[model samples]
Target chain A: MADIILNPYYMQIASFILINIILGISIYITLSTGLLSLGSAGFMSIGAYTSALVTMKLGFPMPLGIVSGAMVAALAGILVGIPTLRLSGVYLAIATLGFGEVIRVWFNNLEITRGALGIPGIPQMGREITGSLREFGITPDMLGLRANQFSALILFFILLILVILTVWFFVRLQRSRIGRAYAAIKADEEAAEAMGINTTYYKVLAFAQGALVAGFAGALYAHTTSFINPGDFSYHRAVEILIFAVFGGSEVIWGPIFGAAFLTLMPEVLRGLADYRFMIYGVLLIVMMAFRPQGIIDYQVLDWLKKKVKRNKSASPLDKQKGGDA
Target chain B: MKKWMKVVGLIVSVMLLLSVVACGSQGTSGEGGEQSGETESGEKVAKIGVISYLTGDGAAYGEAITSGFEMARDELNEKHKGELKIELVIEDSAGKRDQALNAAQKLINSDNVLAILGPTLSSEMFVVGPEANAAGVPIMGTSNTAKGIPEIGDYVFRNSIPESLAIPAALKKAVDEFGIQKVAIIYGSDDDFTVSGYEVMKKAAEDLGLEILTTEEYATGDTDFSAQLTNIQAAEPDAILASSLYKEGGLIVDQARKMGLDVPFVGGNGFNSPQFINQAGEAANNLVVASPWFPERDDAQVKEFVAKFEEKYGKQPDQFAAQAYDALYIMAQAILDAGTVTDRDAVRDALANIKDFDGVTGDFSFDEIGDPVMEPVVLIVKDGKFVEFK
Candidate 1:
């Protein structure tokens, strides 16, 4: 198990899982607020292209590229959300889907994005982290590692930190007033509106937030993979992000994260199956849906776990008495 | 609830066990072959990674590549007579970039393959090439032909002739023989291969002093070319030049012919597949394409390769298969020249130093940038098949 965990191939898979988790969370934010937006991939493309151009063409630092990418995607989200948020349900999904297609086509024909040849050899973020570490008098050779290996380790920790911070932000949002407004909007929009809530404002806000997260993920993805293309943000990719959210149970913040991680790792684990892996993946999804329609990690499971923990805490004194008797 | 949970847990455990057993069986089978080869040779087995799109949109090309690699593998083993056994660890990318990356990583880190062949598409090569190069693993692209591919790194190489070399050959033929003064150009704007092919064709046409009367663009997988064809027909160019894969190129030919535009259609390497002729049927006639391989070539190596490939795969080998076959042989010859399979740098150096490798494809040699320096043939579709044009 230690060997498997330490394998560089597995480490790469873990990085992919982390990236997908970020993408899943990006979509989950909007889904939680009663909006089924299919624009995450578009936002991701915007972010990826923006950051890639910034770093590659403008010679900006990677950090600045990411911030600018996220900001641009947020601005695009607002522009798209203002009009589309008026529609509800499938209508809104179709609009966003169209928006995603538009972005894909626009990038496909654009001159700066290289017209489908894709921009390659973007600078690696690992080098930046290692450079900073070197300034602190911590050299990679001191730890008996190559520079790239040390870079990868630093990258993994950076992703870990990002994941924790994003999850914490989501948790805080879930307990806040805006989160309640979103829940109310999801539960009964008409009622929420009757109770003096501005449904459109909250919905657009949710969309912009999702776009910001997706853009941030995309910026990181461009730097990590060191390549960006229009095909990477097609409608199929949007559907994949949606699947991650839906399959994981979008009711909770962690559901999409779990879904993305499990799905990302599942194919790698089933590599032995060869050509049958995808077929088996489809079958497993069907079986999972049949058995647990809510998702692999639904709200009910969380509630059950919470109740079990409470029960265990309350039974500790009685368990001590029982231990004395034994 | 508890009963359901237990049932789910049991099923999950069974699946996990099955997968574990599957992996064990696979490993043992591979080791079994290696052991026999090693006992006879008294030398360590050389493992090579072959990544291709075995399923999905690009499966046809992938399957052909795999067949070519397998043929090369079997022939090399027989020739060496166990003196230098080669084992191929093939992985399917399913025509997706992420899958290609995963397969490349697994090949480099876990399987410890000496060299990697193919991620099939230019776009995929863009992603996996850098990763492999970074890891110091040599990769030979069997069919990647876009610009700047060989420039990825020193570790990257490709046997397939890029459009830059192939396009001018075919275009010059069309211009000289037919006195083609003006032509219509159509290409898939979304694809790297087609887009690059278009760029090459545009440059070649301009250099040849041939006027480009019209230019049309379509996305891949679009079956309808009436709008583009109609627009082209109005221009009344002497011939049509298309830069696309077999699927879309065939559609364009059929649609162009149906619209009564019977001019000769010139294409690039993407039309070298038999499927293009099969798809367009009678309309496939008069379609000229530049290719690095022609299976019907009256050469001893070509005849033997075609016979073996057809006998094994029960189909005529295309250019993709031909290039892949040569790629495997090139790698094998390089390893033999280097005289070491375990040292990746030695193998890479030997590959870079390879010259005058006569194979099914014309004489193969890598230039300084690791791009192949080989002659491309001009082929025209005649009576539902590709034949060498005089």
Candidate 2:
């Protein structure tokens, strides 16, 4: 296990899985609020191109570039969400998909984005961190590692923190007043509105938050991969993210994370199959849907697991007392 | 509910177990006998990696290229006999950049291949080429012709000629002979290859004192070119220059001809394949293209390669296959010259220093940046075939 973890090849795969998990969670946020906005890839593209340009063109610090990327995407998300959130279900999905295509086409024609040639040679985050550390009196020999040697590890830790914070945020939101309002809107928008909940605001809020998360993921992806192109963020990518959310059980917060990680790792693990990997992957997905259509994890399964743990805890003392009496 | 969950669990576990067994069997059958293949001279076997899109939109190119690699591998093994046996570890990239990166990483780290042959497309190359260069693994691109590919690093090399060299040669020849005074251009704006090709054509056209009437663009996978053709026809230029892949290029030509625009059409490297002619049929009659390889050349090496490739693959080899076939032989020659495939740096230096190496395309040498300096041929479609334009 240590050997596997230490391998740079596996590290690259692990980093990729982390990035996809972030993207999955982005779409999951919107699905949880009952709006299937298929526009995370657009926000991601905005984030990637913005952060890349900020770093490469302006020579800004990496953290600032990433933050600005998320902020810009959030702004764009709200701008799009204000008018489009009125539509529901497939209508909203189609609108968001159109928005995604518009963004890609804009990137393709924009001179600042270098048109279709794409902007290459974006600086990696690992290199910037190491350079700062070295300037602060850390010896290179003491570190005993190259810039990219620790890149995947740094990305892993960053993703770990982001995931933990995101999960915590969603759990807290599920219990808060806004969270209940979102739940009511998702259950029945007209009923929720009659019950004095502002469905429009909450739905739009959900879209904006989802965009924010996706944009942040895109920023990280750009810095990690050191390359960005319009083709990288297309309708196909958006659909893939939706699949991650749906396949993992969007009803629960953990579903999209599991879905993203599992799907991303599946192809890498099946490397031995050569060209037949995708066929086997399709077969497995079909089987999975046939068996557990709701998803691998859902709210009901979580509730059942909670009950099982509680029963075991409550029954332990009773069994102990009976044994003593006997 | 509980029964259903249990059944589902059982099925999932069974499928996973089956796959694990399949992987185990393949590993044992493929690489398990490497130890016993060593000769009395204590020379170890050489392992080379091939990465290409075996099953996707670009799979046709991948199929042809891999076939070429296999043909060359078989011939090398037969020629060398017991001295050195080349073991190929092939991986599929599916024409995606991330998949290509993963394939390259696995090839370099796990398979431990001395060198990698291809990742098929230029977009894939832009992402994985640097990764291989950083890992100190030499990668030779067979079909990557976009600009800045060889500029990826010192460890990167390509046998395919870039549009910068190929486009100018063909454009100059067309203008000088055909007397094309004014020209209109159309290209796939979304793709790096077509975009770069358009850039080269634009510069070359201006350099040759040709008037640029208008320029039009379309996305890849778009079959309808009637609108773009009508717009270009309004310009009424002496000729039309198109920078597109074979499929769309053919459609553009057919549509333009059907619209009664009877001017000559000059194309970039993307139309080099015979598929362009096959798809456009008689409409491709006057279409001229710039390419690095023409199988009909009267050369012994070219004849043998064309015959062997046709015999093996049951189809005429395109420029993509020709380059791939040449790439494998070049790698073999470099290894033989270096006398050790285990030393990657030695092989890279030897590969860079190759001079006047004869290939099916042309006799070329690697420049300082590891790009091939080969002459691009001007070919025209006549009588449903590609022949020298002259």
Candidate 3:
């Protein structure tokens, strides 16, 4: 099992799945606050170019580049979120959609980012981080890993940590005062503002948080793929990111993770279908939506499952047997 | 709840079915490899993976490339007879970078191919090239004409003429033939191919001591070129140099003609297609471009290949098909020369050492950096057909 999972083929797929899960959760953050911003792709591009350029030109280490990428994206998110957050629903979506195009065109024309030519040969996180560790007299062989396996293993762990951290952050945020403010704003923006809840502050905060997560995901994505052009982040990508949250059920943190993992793996699993691969994938998504309009793991399903488990534990022996039979 | 259960069951069943298919394919491939080995017929089989846009917007190019490979495969197997056999593993990238990367990874790791042929576009190359190079597999680009492709790694190779070579050759011919003193430039700025081609055209025009009047840019999917054509007309240059794909390149030429800006229009490799003439119609006349493949060339080999291709595909072969045919033949020759079907390192060396190999595209060889070193022929559109420019 370890060998199968650690092989280069599965490793590549695993990395992509993890990156997509991060993107899924990133959009989920904004969706939870009821803000339909189509700017995740823009924030992702920001993080990608920022880290790529800094690491390549300024000699920043991979970790630093990743952080700076997320930070810069958060800053842009704040700048974009402040003015655009006032517009609700589809209007905000359009504004953010335009923002995405503007960023794409900006990178296309910029000389430093190499326009549409893209920056290739960016250092992979696994090899670069492992090489630096070797300089400090630690070696991958000591951990029973080959050179290639060592790099892939390191990248896998880094992404795993980021995934865990994002999930934990959301879990905590959902229980806090800001989370309630977000819920309130999402439930009714005018009412929340009437109640003096500082709706704009919480909305902007949610947007920036979403941007930060997306930016970090993008930074890692660029390093793993080792190439990025302006075309990589387009309007289609923005919509795809939103689909992750929508498909997975935006109400819970696990929804986006499940959604991202399923969707990302579906294409690879369907590879044998050749020309019909994407067609089948689209059909599957349609089927999933048709079957579960509120998504597979929405609040009602969870509540029902919880009640059923409780009843199973407390019922009489005869009732328990009947329940089991049913 | 029942719907959810049904959906879950469906997902699980589909996954199981697909896994069985994947395993079944792998099993057959293994059996085939062993069967080839066991046969005392002295026949060798080489697996070469092909990644191209078999669907989506770039499907036209992909279809042409696929047909070219199929034709070359049929001819090579028959010609080589008992000595060699090439088994191609074709994967569609759908003209996307991630999909291209996934295709390359699958080809390199799952299929265990000795080499890879293409991912079509240069943008796809930028992503797939590094992956193939790192895996130590030789990948040759059939249609990636962007700059800095070969620079990705020693393992990367391209037979397609880069715009840097084609654009300069076309401009020089235009300068000598038309005696043009000045030129205006227009290109699609959103694409890597056209942008690089534009950069090459600008430098080439300046190098030939021609004055550039004005430059205009448009996005790739844009159909209206009147705004940019009007700007070019206002500049009043002797000729208009354009670096764009056939879609926009044709429209720009057509728009320029309608706007009464008639001078010889010199274009990069993008304008070397029959589709360009189809798009521009009568306006296509006097349009000049450089190409490595010319079906109308007075060569017996070229004529035979073109005739055979038309018979097979029931359509005229374009430059893309010609290049792809040449690329596969080049791969087969290298595999035969190395005398080892599975040893990739030996095959890579043989491919690099390919010298004076004649193909439908003309005599071809790889320079020090794995870029094609061949003279491109200058052709002008005349009466909706390409003819050798004097």
The top-ranked prediction according to lDDT is 3
lDDT of 2 by residue, B13-53 (tens): 97689668667855864575363235677655778889999
Give the Cα error of residue A128 in candidate 3, in Å. 2.6
Regions of model 2 farther than 4 Å from truth: A126-149, A304-326, B33-41
Error of 3 at A84 (Å): 1.0
DockQ for model 2 equals 0.45
List model 1 lDDT by residue over A11-116, tens digit each.
Answer: 6777788889999999999998889999999999999999999988999888899999999999999999999998889999999999999998899899989888
B148-182 per-residue lDDT for model 3 (tens digits): 99999999999999989998998899889999998
Judged by DockQ relative to the true structure, which candidate is superior, 1 or 2? 1
Candidate with the greatest DockQ versus the true structure: 1
- Measured against the true two-chain complex, the DockQ scores of the candidates, in the order shown, are 0.54, 0.45, 0.45
Model 1 reaches what TM-score against the true structure? 0.94
Q: A1-326 in candidate 2: lDDT tens per residue?
A: 85565456777788788889889888987887889899999999999999999998998888899989988999999999999998889999999999999999999999999788887777766556656777998744565654445554566667677767877888898899988887888788899999988788888888898999899989988887777889999999999998898788888878898889889988877777777788878887888788778778887678777998999977899878888899
Ranking by lDDT: 3, 1, 2
Residue pairs with colliding backbones in model 1 are none
Candidate 1 deviant stretches above 4 angstroms: A1-6, A127-140, A307-326, B1-41
What value does the lDDT take at residue A158 in candidate 2?
A: 71
